[model samples]
Target: MADVKLDIRPVGAALGAEIRGVDLNHLRDDEFAAIEQAFADHLVVFFPEQDLTPDGHREFAARFGELEVINGLKKLDDQHPEIVVLDDAVTPAADVWHTDVTYRESPPITAILHMVECPPVGGDTMWINLYQAYETLSPPMKEMLEGCTAVHVNRYGAGNHEHPVVRVHPVTGRKSLYVNRIFASHIRQLSRPESRVLLEFLYRWCEQSRFSVRYRWSPGGVGMWDNRCTLHSVVNDWSGSRIIQRITVLGDKPTGLGEPRWPKFEPNANGASDFYDKNYPF
Candidate 1:
């Protein structure tokens, strides 16, 4: 294969980049290496106008790691069991910010999504830099979070898992806030009231506009993000058909700083405390 030069442009101050001058279907080995480097540096990368087939999309994603079928989610088809099709017509769009499948013992390392169809306007996606989220915290807040673990459970009855509130990234050795509103239920080190208050504060802090990048989707545009150090959500502002297909690379169990052992608090029923139900009322 011939050498290819890439034009990488940062889309936000916190965490996103757009790569030009390479096609997903025909990426050279050297180009892929640069792509990998860009992914590590940017946390989330987008490649616009690459019309890739389903098999091509899977092949590109498989290069980063083992592609896993998302638990409690249906696959796009039997031929491509690893792909999850997100069609707005049939599926409920997620507007809440979240890291994918954190309820699992091992959550996804990364996610690659290809927009098969795009609405004429709206339907943009947003990503948060979790590293910045952790870094921006006060010293005391960081110290407190590093010592705590939080519970995450799938809303669809998949499974429950506890991970460090602050997780150190395996590759970069940088720390990130691992909790999200969708799956992360509560912190174990604090009482229910304390946990709820702290978790809510962290949730709001992590989602500030200064730490995010919003991408407007177009047909054949492919976006990928490192799930270990980021949270993402969709803007539910569109009214027409919008479809995306995604493949996720599997990750290992999260390792926390100090691995501090604390008394395990009993998790709320279905990962929802009575307070949450009464107040939130979803």
Candidate 2:
């Protein structure tokens, strides 16, 4: 295995580790274990210089968990209908910094994105390490988020869906800061104005520069990241087209999906929750 030399390296502060040994085209079980361990230590892994068809990418990602069916995206291939194909030629949504489809009650566990087409210059993907993002916060801020929950959504304004601010990972059982700029409208169960004040403050910190890492892409490159604990953005400055085939592993409901402070609301309830309505004044 040492002869294979899994040239592991960190790409971004968001905890991306690049792997240079195993080929996804023909992965062995033990080699796969090495990659998974690298993922545990690094949270993200990229395999470069291996040629993969859409089937190859899906096959590799399925080894991790059940494949996710993207609600409104085209399938990569008939045989592998669960894959999501993301390319640079997409609409503006693809460029946004998001933890893929957090609008759902239960989001995906991880995501594997393979860069098939890359730009000549200027086009990189950025990710933020939520685990580190939470650890580095001031004690007061940490306290505020610990007992609080924020709504995440894709509907319009914030979180797009309602969920807690600090959630325990189902796989690792470790708590991570869950809010992101893509959604995270505000903290429900609090007065509208107070919620806004706190939510904005938290969002700013989560978006801080120190928590992120950027990865420049090349063809035949694959990056698999823990979606539950990281937020990623594909830079869209290139004039030319860049295409990437992405696969997601669906996850379960967040550990603290519906707490008294973080009540669950209808999928598209304009930010009002049952707990807030029945208990809070504003």
Candidate 3:
């Protein structure tokens, strides 16, 4: 395939770009480099109107890093475990804002999504830049947060995982607010009441419209985001059916600023139940 100069267009002031003139099915080494750079610069990139087979999707995701085969998801084919199918009829749309798989010790660094079908209107997705979320906080707030850790719990058997309240990006050396409304249960350093209050404030602060970008999906379009420094949620107002396939690239354990204010996290036999007692606001 001949090399075509990538036509990159910024979608929002905070964090998204749409790249035209490149085919995901056949990306050259240099073209892939440009795409990677765009991802790093913008935190999320979208490629519109490209036909990609399951194998091609997996191959493109693998170019970024090692692929993670996720369980408990509907698969496109039993032979292709790496690519999972998401049918809105079967799985309800995710209405809450969240980072992908933060309940794991090593969450995915990047998420690549391929749109198979979508509603004509109202099923857009939005992403927030956590880097901006962290940077905009007052100095005292940053000081208090630098040494904190938070526990994230999944209702499922995946159990609990603890991460820094403020995580430093492995590649960019940038700090980002890592807690979210969905999985993040509480701050490890504070009391239950204090954690709730603080988490609620951070949640509202991080999701301000100034730091987000909303994308409308189209069939055969592809969207990928840096999960390390962003939170995403889907708008649930659409009717009809929506279908997509996803592949994730494995990431390293998150590192935070300075030392943790508390000891390492270890769950007892009671599991996440301890965190889900009557006091849990949700």
**On TM-score, who's better, 1 or 2?**
1
The predictions' CA RMSDs to the true structure, in order, are: 4.6, 5.2, 4.7
Deviation (Å) of 156 in candidate 3:
2.3
lDDT of 3 at 132: 99
Cα lDDT tens digits, model 2, 59-85, are 898888888776667677787777667
Candidate 3 residue-wise lDDT at 195? 81
After superposition, the stretches of candidate 1 with alpha carbons farther than 4 Å from their true spots are 1-5, 70-74, 265-282
Best by TM-score: 3
> Against the hidden true structure, what lDDT does model 3 obtain?
0.88
What lDDT would each prediction earn against the true structure?
Answer: 0.88, 0.73, 0.88
lDDT of 1 by residue, 1-282 (tens): 225557999999999999998889877789998898888889999999998888889889989989887656668788999999888998888899999889999998988999998999999999999999999999998998899999898878888888999999998899999999999887876767788899999999999999999998789999999999999999999988898898989988998997755665544735756553344212
Which of 1 and 2 is the better model by lDDT?
A: 1
The TM-score that candidate 2 achieves is 0.83
What is the lDDT, from 0 to 100, of the residue 92 in candidate 3?
A: 81
lDDT of model 2, residue 201: 73
TM-score of 1: 0.90
Task: Show where candidate 2 strays beyond 4 Å.
Answer: 1-5, 156-161, 256-282
